[model samples]
Target chain A: MIKLTYRDAVRRALADALRADENVIFFGEDVAEAGGVFKVTPGLYEEFGGERVMDTPISEEAFIGAALGAAITGMRPVAELMFADFVPVAMDQIANQIAKYRYMSGGQFIVPLTIRAAQGAGAGFGTQHSQCVESWLLNIPGIKIVVPGTVKDMYGLLRTAIDDNNPVIVLEHKVLYNYAEEIDEAELTHVPLGKAAVRRVGKDITVVATQLMMHRSLDAAERLAGEGIDCEVIDLRTMIPLDEETILESIAKTGRLVIVEEAPHAGGWGADIAALAADKGIYWLDAPVKRVNMGGALIAYSPPLEDEVVPNVSRIADAIRAVMRA
Target chain B: MTQNGIALPAQMRQDMLKKMLEIRAAEERIQGLFLENLVRGTTHLCIGQEACSVGVAAVLQPGDTMTCTYRGHGHALAMGMTMKALMAEMMGKASGACKGKGGSMHMTDASIGLLGANAIVGAQLPIAVGAALTSRLKKTGNITVTFFGEGAANIGAFHESLNLAAIWKLPVLFICENNLYGEYSVWSKTTPVRDIAVRASSYGIPGIVVDGQDAECVYHEVSAMAERARRGEGPALIELKTYRFRGHSRTDQAPYRPKGELEEWLKRDPILILKERMIADGQLDETEFEELRESIDRQVVEVVEWAKTEPYPPVEALYEDIYYEG
Candidate 1:
């Protein structure tokens, strides 16, 4: 076992993939010599040289679309979008081209592509740079969505995503770059997508979260445990092809649910989870499912205002209490 | 007929004429089927842009790939997609090129390296660049060509893709079929420059303008650009001056075009000009040209009848092909 930061784990995973397969190439703005804005891809350019780790012009649509084209031809490309907030600029390529090519081509093509982007709003990067837009990609078919909260998951999910035969979006929270944890070397080798990890087990309310919210919820759960209120937390590793069975089973046991997310409450991934419980596990629920999320407003630049707009540990704890009380 | 001051072989010249006629005949047949309500959804026909499709396709090797816009019937035919599959696809049949899922606008055949025919304007630019990146990374010596309209040249994707292609030295050719109209708006209203190829100078890559109605001219220009790309000289942009003889979609009457403009363009029809040049040069007789047209017309008619009898995809097909199950 060894310790590693989330950023280092990601860099190691990318370097490993590049070494394992010559077809795997990394391309994005400032990824080569600059080593990425977040430093997640540090030393890749020096290690693999420019051809394998390329620095592209600040053209998200072009690079993203080019990554899709490269995937269809014969290479596994990992494209970094810098920030998830800027994904809308390349929505046509993501939603229409990358997501539809396989089905549209009648199984003739496979897009072994991974798009890595920093999401969530705690760093005071303002509206454009700080936002969790994973919901925008949830409805898109043919693309898998992965949000890794731990160092082990960051390494394993990235490796798995690189090896997968479809387009996968890896949403790394901006704040998690410095977050470090102990890792089992074997666990870091492979963490299959589409599986939920049970962080805590309890008989009270069930709290489901992703990305940054997962860590916040775990913190909230620990506090609640001291208050004689036990909360079971599940980190939803992948949003698409969601681990519904795990969530439903947890709901069946707890009979109450609290969904925490960084995106706006309306049309967020929380709604999808709430709907799933409402539709199939209605009889299992003792109370209406509660969703804790950011309100519908542009993320402000001020530190306090940004903090107020995004979900926090207290907000998740409050939602868990409300659902349990109901 | 001469191409680039060199006489093209009789067989090559004859094949070009045959391909152009096939596209024209198929498009005309599709118009009739659309009027009869046989084809579901909408189709953007390439009735008058046959030269641009055939000219560029004529230079592509077996491994070379190409992508196009919604008006891609001519491009698909030029790339050697079977009439039976394309016709079935327009009719939404199980035996279609995309198993009836892509319909007319998204026609694709990966076997022949027809990546896809995107409906979104300028979406295929980066995709083609990506293919080129793959070719360069793997040292495959293959090239990719993407076709779009004048309006797409003004899009952010076009500029970004061209810039990246030049900086990375990717093997791609960007072909702009400047047909003077974008949906209902004239080119002058939307574009700032008279020649879209001049925009390529900003990227430090070679750019040229050609007579789109002259198949020989388009062939010569694209062949040179493609050769440069394959030799690792980076990307180039070619703008073909042409006109669309039909409406943008099935419902459009094209009332926005200037009076007498259609008649003038019709006089310089690409198919007619090629046929006349071949006859005048004694490479083909007038009777032989007529027979060639008749043969293509007969093939298109048979394919339409065959498509009518084919079945729609099964209900299970809807859930399949979204991801690579393996």
Candidate 2:
């Protein structure tokens, strides 16, 4: 068993990919010598050299588009956008071009591209810097959305993303990078896209969480367990081809559902999943599916204001209790 | 190589003029069809900009790649994409290059190395740079050309793609078809610079401005640049000074263009200059020119009729091309 931080797991995945394939390359602003602003790509430039790991100009659209073009021509390119907020500048290329190429071209072309961006609100980065914009990307079709909550999922899902013959958006929670977990190196296997993992199984209430919220959900589950409320927790590793079956099965077993998310409550992936449950798994629910999500506002710079904006373990616990009571 | 103008062979000159006239006449026909509502959807006619496409395309090898913007019918046609395919694409028929899914803005024919056309301004620049990079990496000896307008020169993509091309010495020709307008707006009102070509010098590469109304002048410069690219000498920035005679799309007469400027540019009509010069040089007589026009007209009519007879894409095609075979 190897103990690694979420960031280390990601670094390991990238290292493995670079070592395994010569065509795999990476480029982004301050990604080379700086080893990525978040240190997710640390030591890669030294091992692979500039030809494989390059520092690009501050042009998100171009570098991302370059990644797409490279991927189409048999290179597995991992493009790092400094922040998730900057992804909007390259949305047309990602959403309109990368996502639609395989389908639009009738399978004549394949975009084996992976776009990695640091997401979530932490470190007091103001409104612009602090945003959980994974929901926006989730709305786009034809691309897989991978949101890794743990070091294990980070290592596994990223490897799977690089290998997938489709465009994949890997949204890393900024807050979870330093979070450590002991994982078996051999067992730290690549998880298939669209599959969810049952983090903590229970029968009282089902808690669906992703990214940072998954940790919070687990904490809430422990707190609820002390209060004699056995809450089932499911980590939605991939959001797009969401493991609806796992979520609905948990809901069916528990007969209660509480969805937790760090992004704003309105129009988040939680709502999409809740709608799916409402429309398809209505008979399986014991009560109305409760959604414990961040308040509708931008994540503020001040610690207090930021704390007020995002959902916490207490809120999730309260939501699960409310759903259990109902 | 100097930025000074180069001489053109008589044969090459005649061919350039003929290509320019073909694009000019075809664009005029497209405009007529659009105005009569026969060509459904929006059409970005490159009427006065024939010299740009003809000039750049004249330099390309059969296997070289090219990418363009929404105003790409001229590029596609000049690169030998059949008028039938383009017209069928405009008419939303299965015979279209992308089988009617791409429409006008997303035309693609990878068989001829026409990678694709993007509607987003400056988007294709990076893709072209990447394509050139791939060619160099694989030692394919094939170059890539991307066409954009003067407005795109100021975009972050233009700077990034150009810098990458220059730094890597990639065989990329950044063809700026400076048509004075981006959509219904004029670049003079938006851009601070008088000439977009001047910006290329900042990237440590040669930037040249050619008379976009004279096809032979534009062609000679592009041919030299293409030759330079084949020798791995590096990328070039060629700005073709031209004007858009039609509206940005099918509708909306451009109210932004000044009356005197429009009339002055119209006086330098590329088709007329080519026709007159060809007759004056005795390379083509009036009778031969008239016969050629009739032949082209007949070809256009036949293509449109053939396209009309083709069936629309099946409904199942919607789910067909979204991913490659696993």
Candidate 3:
């Protein structure tokens, strides 16, 4: 067991993957010598050498597309997008090419491609650099998405993503990069995707969240535990192959649900969760599901303005309380 | 080596000639099927650009992989995909290359080394670069060829992919088939440079231009570059000055073309150029050319008939191919 930050754990997972397989390679802007824009992949270049670890030009479409092509040709490439906000610039390659390559190729290609990007609000990177855009890819099939909130999930899910025979995008929240925890190093290897982690178990209300919201939801659960309202917090580890079973089971136990997300309510993944609870888990619900999402605005440069839109601990707790009252 | 290209054995020349004819036949037949409402959705055809496809594929061996735009039936056929698979894919039959899922814009047959074709402009450039990255990392001694148009050179992916391939010295050939028009707009209007290959200097790599109508010229340049890349000499951008015979897609008459442009281009039709050269070299006769065309046309028609009997993929198939279960 060792104490490590979320960033260090992610770097550890990458080192493990490189050590485990010669086919595993890494590349992105400043990923080689500079570690990464977030300094999450430092020392990998020196450890693995330039052939396996490279620094690509700031061309998301090229590197992302290269990841797909390289995966098809049998090399596992871990590409970094720098910031999730930059995804739009290469949306064509990410959405059309990487996401559809396997299906379009008649299941003939095995794409063991992993793309990691720094996501969510922190460091005052503003709208173009701080948005949590994982929802932008939910509609695009043939992609597996994982957003890890803790050091454990970061290491576990990333190891799994590198080994999985598909394209997986690991959205690492910028705010959580420095989040520290003591974890058993051996236990964090190859955590299965499509499964949710029950962060805190309770019977009053279920709080479903992921990434930055996952941490806030856990905070809400702990704070609410003092008030007699017990919240069951479920951290959705994988986004695309959603762990609906866990959400449903938790909802069945609690009979009340509050969904927290960094994206706006409009066209967000939370809507899908709400619809899922309504359609499949309605019988268990004692109250309508309350969604705590970005307050219908873009993430601004100012921290206060950004806070108004980003779902936080207080907002999550409020939603849980409102659901409990109902 | 001849003035036109590397002098090849009789078998190789015959194969190139036949493949070019088959690509032309297939493109023409697809248009007819579209008019008859047989091929659903839409399709982009590479009719007059058979030489460009044939020339590139002719030099590549079985281990070499390729990716191209939606107008890649020519590339597919040249890469050894059967007429039945190509035509059946557009028809969305169960026997289609993508099992009737990808429809017309995406066609992939990996067994023949074709990664797939993408519908979006400039999306496949980075994918081929990825494949090249694989070759470099794995020391596979194989190359990847990606075909795009003049318009793609202007997109960020093109420059990004070129720079990515350049710095790493990845074994990739960026084949830009400059067909004058990127949809409705002329190349000159969209691109500042007269020669797309000249832009390769920005990445400090060699860029060569070839007369796309002459299959031998494209073959010569691609083969040379492929060899150079296989020798670990890094990537190169090759521009083939070609033209498409038809409008982009769906009922487009290409009224955007200037006066006499079509007629002038028609005189240099890739198939005609190859046919004239083959005849002058006494490698082919009028009867052989006629017989080959008739045979290819027959195969094209036969595939449509075969597809008529083939059903669409079962409804359950929709749930499949979306993810790799393992």
Best by lDDT: 1
Residue A231 of candidate 3: its Cα lDDT? 85
Clashes of 2: 3
Better model by lDDT: candidate 1 vs candidate 3: 1
Question: Which pairs of residues collide in model 1?
Answer: none
Best by TM-score: 1
Worst 10 residues of 2 chain A by lDDT: A101-110
Q: Please report how far candidate 3 places residue A294 from its true position, in Å.
A: 2.3
Model 2 accuracy (lDDT, Cα): 0.83
DockQ of all models, two decimals each: 0.88, 0.53, 0.77
- Pairing residues by index, what is the TM-score of model 2? 0.94
Candidate 1 docking quality: incorrect, acceptable, medium or high: high
lDDT of 2 by residue, B73-179 (tens): 88998888888888888777777888888887877888787888887788888888878877777777888999998888877889988988898888999998888
Poorly placed runs, candidate 3 (over 4 Å): B1-8
Could you list the CA RMSD of all candidates, in the order they appear?
Answer: 1.6, 2.5, 2.2
Interface root-mean-square deviation (Å) of every model: 0.7, 1.7, 1.2
Give each model a TM-score. Answer: 0.98, 0.94, 0.95
lDDT of each: 0.91, 0.83, 0.86
Sorted by DockQ (best first), the order is 1, 3, 2
